[model samples]
Target: MSKFTSILARTFLQCRPMTNVSTKNMNMLSLMKSNSNPINRLAILSISDFNKRHKSSATSSLADKELATFLQDEIENETKSMETKATSPTFEGFNTELKDAKVILTKKSGKESFKVIFNVNNSLDNNSEEEYSEQKNVSDNKSNEDVELGSPISKPTYTIELEKNGQIMAFYCSFAEEGSYEDGNQSSPDSAGYSDLYRIDEISIYQNEYTDDSYSVTCDLLDEQMYEKLFNMLEDRGLGNEFASKLAEFSTAYEHKLYVNLLSKIKNFISS
Candidate 1:
């Protein structure tokens, strides 16, 4: 018999006289004394199962505590790292407006006003070293200087609209990360003498607005000289190489801020 059964037997014998016990109660006691009896086996099995469950629950609780601590530390580190890495809120003389995933900037030049619109959703991508170096040139101002090469940065297809006397000329533009200015057109007389960054992909001239039926003229259809003139038209209005670099830095910083907020949400969920 096990030590527990032996102790049980001794306790029962010492607790009462054998002559006073009923026969049925004595039979039950006899069955309990045997390890092979179903009743006794069930009792032992139940105690073992209870101990295992208790141990598992304790281990799970400990793991949860450790995970919570790790998340908290990570949150703190990311928050501190981004404290000074905010994107510049102001972009020269333009009035800035943010709506969800889109950023709108508007500026007036003499009798003409222009709007630059870009979307942040699905715009971020890993940047090459050459492009990253170019982006750093305009980081001297109020925003996003901490982003390094090979990091995820904003590469958006944006739109610029120049309006004068109720007529609007819109340029659908993209950035050329590599080998765009090798044609010796970098010093084009119409250019703002800024670095070659922005590219005019398409141009559309509309009156009173853009409708579903409006036509867009692709830059590929235009000659090199015409394209250069169109590009310079935008550069003169402040959407030049410098603005391109600053906008990229701003977008990177903005995306990082969003990422940190997401991390914070995850941590809160786990802790809760």
Candidate 2:
């Protein structure tokens, strides 16, 4: 079998095939969705509202809209980074100068995982073909599985934010205790265990060009202690568990439009 196919078979790159629900199952889902609990009811309502908005405007689904917004933001950030390098005396080439990047944290069911965004330094790239090759090692730790994921992650613009970030040292996806974390592209997390520290260099603040929000945090020189600090920060704000749970559900569930709403809501909720 081809190396690429081998990785797909074992790695987290393969999304679980979504199965169609039978008519009886659909009825059960309807019944469960009608719970009087505020939280459960809101979820159903949000999903309905999300689909309705798309139909009303004859536009993309909420999930698509969110994905588009994320990619657009990534592009804008990457372009700004490139512009700085082009004007700099030490500027190298486009391939070396990373415009934008992202890393998704993976965990099993009921675990907390999230995604982080960062840019790159073109000067730092080793420029090896293997660095960006289709046969490159995937971030999975269960085994030495190979999958394709370099700059821009996937060919589709919408998949840009899904790219895992790296430079000299590189980044690996975090794993949960013992479960599948499809959202983070991490498989067999339980078997391999999780990494505490996610070392990154040359990180910087995300320039809020689209909005007037003050978010100046350069994770430059982030160390092991600092990684723990992030979780502590979330915990201090009392959003650590909630954040992880929402992310897990969003990653595995088939109807993602509702998760988009949840993500936006969480973004606003925590940012406030």
lDDT top scorer: 1
> How do the residues 127-168 of candidate 2 rate in per-residue lDDT, one tens digit apiece?
333455433345443256554344311111110111123211
Q: Please state the error at residue 156 of candidate 2 in Å.
A: 16
Off by over 4 Å in 2: 1-203, 210-221, 254-272
Worst 10 residues of 1 by lDDT: 182-191
How many steric overlaps are in each model, in order? 0, 5
Q: Write the per-residue lDDT of candidate 1 for residues 153-260, one digit (tens) a residue.
A: 677878989899999999888777544354433323344644566677788989979998889988777887777787677677778778887887877677667767
lDDT of each: 0.75, 0.37
Model 2 lDDT-worst window of ten: 153-162
Question: Candidate 2: lDDT over CA atoms?
Answer: 0.37
